[model samples]
Target: NLASQLTISKSQPIISGIDDIKNGKVPGNRIGLLVGSASLEYYLTAVSGGNPNYYPLYSRDQIYQNLLGNKIDVGFIDTGNAEYMTNDVYCNLTIAGSGFN
Candidate 1:
């Protein structure tokens, strides 16, 4: 799980590619991009088109908690952490696509 991708709750539909992201067909639009993370580009370019209205999480725990709590619908994270978090620590989440480096 060395790649990176969008992570969403199992309750949401899986997004198979970047087209889904750009088309507003993601796991719900309430995105949580951690401040200062590389994921910001995705949120702004793919999700918001530079609107900056997406939810801004401050930490890894905060992002996971928000997703689990339904405060946010999705997050962008490294696939390694995404795998461990979803498969081992939290079973209700999943990577949205095949992931990229």
Candidate 2:
């Protein structure tokens, strides 16, 4: 029952769609995922066709911080967390895509 959403920093090149990620247009090493979330990890791997470049983050706040700092180019977060991050003043993130359980 894990739903996830893709987000990127406002400064990143606009990702037109999910195809960019699947085709390896997006740098693999720059993708971030929650450290302990098995579902997020699995989804990233499955979507990327088994390419493993997803960085494991400590928490949702860390994901936001790393993304804003350009430490990571993209991140997968809980859908609800994505909504909050997008609306929060401190987090300048854009919704790139969404996936459901």
Candidate 3:
């Protein structure tokens, strides 16, 4: 049921897209994520079957800046925050799609 839900909707699965995933030059890409957030930790665990490399930012604003400047390829943010972030000028980030991290 969880897997089905993840595949079907953007609500529960909380996925982010890789620029490389859409473009042809590269295949899979790394996703930036928050260190303390349980959702991020869960996604990381699920993807790697263990912990993986993640960049820890001090503030959400810092993460927004990084996303804007392209320092990090992509990030996993909650859907509620995602809406605001996309609308924010500093980030100007967009939701690429829906899937598990």
Q: What's model 3's lDDT at 23? A: 46
lDDT of 1 by residue, 1-101 (tens): 23567787888665665567668765344777788777776567656778777788889888889988988877878777888988899888877877764
Q: Candidate 3: lDDT of 62?
A: 61
Candidate 3 residue-wise lDDT, 1-101, digit = tens? 11101111223223434323334222123345566775455655554345555556666566566656556655556666666656664333566565333
Whole-model lDDT values for every prediction: 0.75, 0.74, 0.47
Q: How close to the true structure is residue 22 of candidate 3, measured as C-alpha lDDT?
A: 34
> Candidate 2 — which residues are off by over 4 angstroms?
none
Candidate rank order under lDDT: 1, 2, 3
Error of 3 at 76 (Å): 0.8
Check candidate 2 and list the clashing pairs: none
Predicted structure 2, TM vs. truth: 0.81
TM-score of 3: 0.59
Candidate 3 Cα errors over 4 Å, as ranges? 1-30, 88-91, 99-101
Model 2's number of clashes is 0
Largest TM-score belongs to which candidate? 2
- Candidate 2 local lDDT, 25-85, one digit each (tens): 7777788878768645565556666655678788888888888888888787777878886
